[model samples]
Target: MRKAVLLALFSLGFISCVSVKNLPQNPSPYISKIDLVKGVKQEGERIVPVPFKGKIGENPVIFLILKNAEGKNRVKFRLYAGKTLREEYEISFGKPGEYYSRVIIWQGLKARKKGTYTLAIFLNESLLAIKKFRIEGLRQGP
Candidate 1:
């Protein structure tokens, strides 16, 4: 019938418009969880998670869990002391196969100042996650 045809076309157009608006802005891998840990240990091709408080000492480690990560990708971590950019670290992945889930660990970062610090994680130049922590009882030597 003519009425059925018009209703079908209307539904199709409405569905297409809704889907277009729901599309993700960034097609890069998604980070499911981010954690600040003291250190990481490797065991049989896996990085073991370590316990950590919101406050850290000299060296700080960052742990990230990502999903839908495939092919070559770059991850960057920016550390800020208060509002000042303190350190930046980058990691590159060049794997052939697709990784549905991946674990990344970044270490060897030394916290120099004693105050609030913010860690920003970027996936292929896009901001993915952010975390804040504090450092106390830090002794500065002259």
Candidate 2:
């Protein structure tokens, strides 16, 4: 009975390690941080900064902030525009020194049709995080 229970536990652990299909294609890419922010706004006496609050579809812009320290930071993004991954962009992120390469997605983008879209972030060929957002009308009279 002990051996049977051990085998079952081992099998469960192994099964949980199934591969993530949507991860990056590279093996060495390192991602330090990823954040989803609302539209950029100008704080008093300061330059443009990420807004603190806004709904996903209500905001005028969305920021995909990727950060890394090593030289192998990379980005592979799939923009699901309806029923499939209609748009994809692969970008090589620069080595983290003074800036985190920020990928900005503008709302009301003619390319971004209205529907539910998901943004996936990968690190070192592993699925690090996934952010889901909806694209709606732009903030009027901005």
Candidate 3:
């Protein structure tokens, strides 16, 4: 009986440590390119998260690429889905500056059923840019 219990615990530990395979949620939301005119560029876009789509219940991760001119920058990006959906993505730009993000269900809500979803990228708390994306049944490969 003790051996069986140990085996069960071992299996559970291994399962928890196993990495989950998710798809890139598409269109690759990113900085794309920055046309810096002397100062740090305040321009950004919501690119489709590439190479992964993810499962229905799986929490989606987001990545942001910040661009600056002349020097590094301390900037942030805000995301909004609905009244209860919100995330503030903070970033500091350096070489290969990539910010990681995730999507969570608020008020038992999923983006697909919520109709239109909006993600607003802000520079210093003011609106710099906004991007729109749709949630459909087509998921990225796991």
Candidate 2 lDDT by residue in tens digits, 11-34 = 998988887779764433244444
- lDDT for each of the candidates? 0.77, 0.52, 0.44
lDDT digits (tens) for residues 1-142 of candidate 3:
9999999999998889977688655432335432211112223653333323333222233344443222334455455565445666566543345433332111111233533455666554556566555454434588
Residue pairs clashing in model 2 are none
Candidate 2 off by > 4 Å = 1-35, 38-48, 57-68, 95-111, 137-142
lDDT, residue 99, model 3: 37
Q: What is the lDDT of residue 20 in candidate 3?
A: 60
| Native RMSD of candidate 1 (Å) | 7.2
The 10-residue segment with the lowest total lDDT in model 3: 33-42
TM per prediction: 0.69, 0.45, 0.36
TM-score of 1: 0.69
- Give the better candidate number (2 or 3) by TM-score: 2
Count steric clashes of candidate 2: 0
lDDT of 1 by residue, 1-142 (tens): 9999999999899887854546655556787777777788889988786756555765667777887787778888898998989899999876777565665656556675668888888888999888898777565679
Clashes of each: 0, 0, 15
